[model samples]
Target: MSVIVGVATLTVVATGFSPHTAERETVHWSYQGSTGPEHWAGLSEDFAACGAGREQSPIDLPEDTAVGTSSDEAITIDYHPVTAKLVNNGHTVQANVSPGSRIIIDGTPYELQQFHFHLPSEHTEDGEHTAMEMHFVHADEAGDLAVVGVLMEKERGDSAFTDLWDRLPTEEGDEAQINEPFDLAEFLPNDRDQYQYDGSLTTPPCTEGLKWIVLDDPVSVTPSQVAAYREVFHRSNRPTQPLNDRVLTLVED
Candidate 1:
């Protein structure tokens, strides 16, 4: 599968679609039962990556890690205000941002594509779970994938996600326009420290060779936001896959 990423365009993660998949790719799978993540590889021959990939994702950040920094891995986000669109892909609620937002990693510019959520977090801290996690999927012109993850914990007051929750498409393959002004920069935590690893996509077709950087710092979301998300997807997060000798680096603050 030859992946083709854009310079800075809106790209949402459709159900059963991977960064490595074609633009018109339509895959059939689910989050549970007969055609679930556990049984994804058997669904089709093209899904071989789901079961046999050595560098799978959503691994627990191992305990007792050393802190370090690398100029080569530094992230510089140049996100701009863009119109948002919401899509209920049956698995989770995905938000697509308009063009203009982009992130430069070590001088390589990666376009800010789309973002989606996973309940109870995916990657954990020594087996600890958070309220939720958001994946900001980005890619370069070559279709190389790089995801920046920000964990969301349960808190009080309101959340930036309220606008999205209000317009979620309950049914599968439903999409709606978001009239609100969406700022991608607002999702960043004050602490830029992160845990970097080489892993595959958490969803089926689980394509490998993607660059993943999960921020150690998490943002806060109101309890109402958590409840609202649960109503839509109670358990969208994939189970933690084995680190399997893969090294996780702690990027110091």
Candidate 2:
């Protein structure tokens, strides 16, 4: 599979929150204070959806309210071992993956572009937050976005993230290259059940029409691993948005 690295000039659209190197310099939104999520829309005319969009992301998944569905409706993830570039993009620590990884939703394939971590899981279950959240961002040929969210809980030890946590870039604009291939599937839980919904990007621009597939089971990561990430990005999470009239589907496998 072909992979695109950091070129001096390149345009990346629709892959949610994975801003190109050039665009990163122009956008200056953070997770707190004056230039935080609350002030994202007002910060720039391009980020209008941050405040105005109704179908925003990171919503609470109240099981009782969700529409039940069988395992047949679950999205098919075809992730494999691949080289990845870990980048500290000011907001969150993101892993820009090589091609070959993808997920099939209703027969349409969306290639996995990257995955990022958010401190204190964004989408909550029963209004409860987890230690962290990981978003696997993918995009179809038409530039439509779909995100797979995995909630992380505090456990004793988890080697799945050892390579990433050990090589985390401490400074903004810094990056670490993992030449050796690593399977992203290791990060997921054994169960494939998920909570499905229609939502938008959790960051600036906050574009809507994204298919959100949040796994129901939380993955295990050590407290120290979470701490290691927090040291780089003290906190990077958008509060849960209102669900509005949208229905949350519980896809059980």
How far residue 81's Cα lies from its native spot in candidate 2, in Å, is 0.5
lDDT score for residue 15 of model 1: 30
> TM-score of model 1 relative to the true fold?
0.87
Model 1: lDDT equals 0.75
Clashing pairs in 1: none
- Candidate 1 displacement at residue 42 in angstroms: 1.5
Task: Estimate, for each residue in 1-253, the C-alpha lDDT of model 1 and write its tens digit.
Answer: 1111111111225532354554543545655666666876886686788888889988888648634667456677678878878887667778778888887876788887788888889889988989999998888888888888899989887677666677877664679997767777677787888888899888766878888889888888889888877776657777888877778888764
Off by over 4 Å in 1: 1-20, 23-27, 70-72
Q: Clashes per prediction?
A: 0, 0
> Cα lDDT of model 2 overall?
0.82
Task: Count clashing residue pairs in model 1.
Answer: 0
lDDT of 2 by residue, 94-183 (tens): 888899999999999999989989888999999999999999999898878889999999889545787778888787668999999998
